[model samples]
Target: DSMGDEHVWELLLPLPTTASTSMALSLLTFRLLLTSSSSSSSSEGYWSTDEFLPENRRRLRDRREKLERTLTESGIPYLPSDSGLFVWMDLREFLPPPPSPDESSSASSSAETESRESMERRERSLYLSLLNEHGLLFTPGLSMKNELPGFFRCVYSAASDGEFELGLERIGRCADAMRRSKEET
Candidate 1:
């Protein structure tokens, strides 16, 4: 509104928030009705949540399993999750080792700070490289306020089976490239 775009403001300012809320509420209500109906045998017209829920659960489980296998094949260690859409994979091994302090620089605090900065930089670089080169994106642990860097959250529930598999392959290839580059150095 402060941008002097009077036409845009005129179009947007008069819209009520209740419209969106009502739409969302009605959709939720519809789903609830269908679910309640499906739970009983008498509702012949309603969609079955029983079938949908189990199938969806199975599909997500399969995806998670496949993702774990891919990460394992890529030699990336991940935290085991009992129930979630994402896996937290540790990439700390890909980070450069912290610098060794000399006798003149015996301060542990400064060394620790430098090590953290280095880890953050390496994680950001790897995140960008994966996105740019392999068309893969992950939630960086830094933004997630993780105490340690190099831990990325990879979601498994957002894509089609083929796309998800392809994404996993891309991640594997990116890991392979990083590993090969490290070996060369």
Candidate 2:
């Protein structure tokens, strides 16, 4: 139900219909109960639900907020997240313009294909530049099957606060450098 998938709902509508599905569902239930029993027990120390769940939620929320603030300050357009660990940021400003059409060529399909390939390379280059130059790992939109060319997924769920801030700073510097280079060209 949480998946909002009708096909899944239909599949599970007749419970115990198939042995494999029934066994899989039962195993999932067993795992959930086992995890609940363990985490609910205070004797588990660090794994106790009371100790870590709220703290982890707070940390994730804080990290997302921080990323939102950095994106705002940098003038980087981003899709406002309602409930997710990742933010979709638009970096189209950093992508080079599409290839100019050849005056003698009437083959628009080839030009379009070339443009797409070129854009993909540019997008990969941006992803690599951030990773290699600043140690920031952002998922390229192309890999995510995003039709838009200049979008990237920025995850905010893992890094510590200090490390996250450092990454943000590095992003700022990279953006500034890209802007400078673009202006020069």
Candidate 3:
């Protein structure tokens, strides 16, 4: 069941515009056939198999390959998959982890109880501020129960290549800003 789900997910993701368009056309044709008074049962055969299925598959495959090549050329870390459109990037190394309670206490002379919470609050604020500033977005980690803080998931789509590049540049700027902010504080 898990394998089937994975297969289905792979198929759904990274669909080329042509495949999507073809599927839409197929649906429309099916609807028309159903409504037409002269619609023959034999005509139903044409709608059964997608006429542009091959072209759609080829286009999607080409797009995936192009994306992979681009990421490789840019030296961006990415997960390679034959079926899926997305190349999941690993950003763990790029992002700094939240300061631990002990680390925060050592860094600040302020009261441990209040300072620890305050520091955490500051870190979360900084992270969100960076995201907002750079136009970068991410889903907070699932393990975060009651706002566990600091964990997040960023999803980069392949649809808008230009937007992705802009977002990455913004992220770089945000990282620099974070470094400067940390140095000042």
Best by TM-score: 2
- What tens-digit string does per-residue lDDT give for candidate 1 at 1-185? 12223332222221211222344554565466444554543244323455545655676688889999999999999998776567999987776565555522336635446555666777888788778877987888887778887888887766655778799888788888988988999
Candidate 2 lDDT over 132-153, as tens digits, reads 8768788789877888788998
Candidate 2 residue runs with Cα over 4 Å from true position: 1-41, 44-47, 103-106, 110-115
Order of the predicted models by lDDT, top scorer first: 1, 2, 3
lDDT of each: 0.67, 0.66, 0.47
Name the 10 consecutive residues with the lowest summed lDDT in model 2: 11-20
Better of 1 and 2 by lDDT: 1
The TM-score measured for candidate 2 stands at 0.69
Candidate 2 has an lDDT of 0.66
Pick by lDDT: 2 or 3, better one: 2
| Runs of candidate 1 exceeding 4 Å displacement | 1-46, 96-109, 115-119
lDDT of 3 at 155: 41
For candidate 1, list the clashing residue pairs, or say none: none
Q: What does the lDDT read for residue 133 in candidate 1?
A: 76
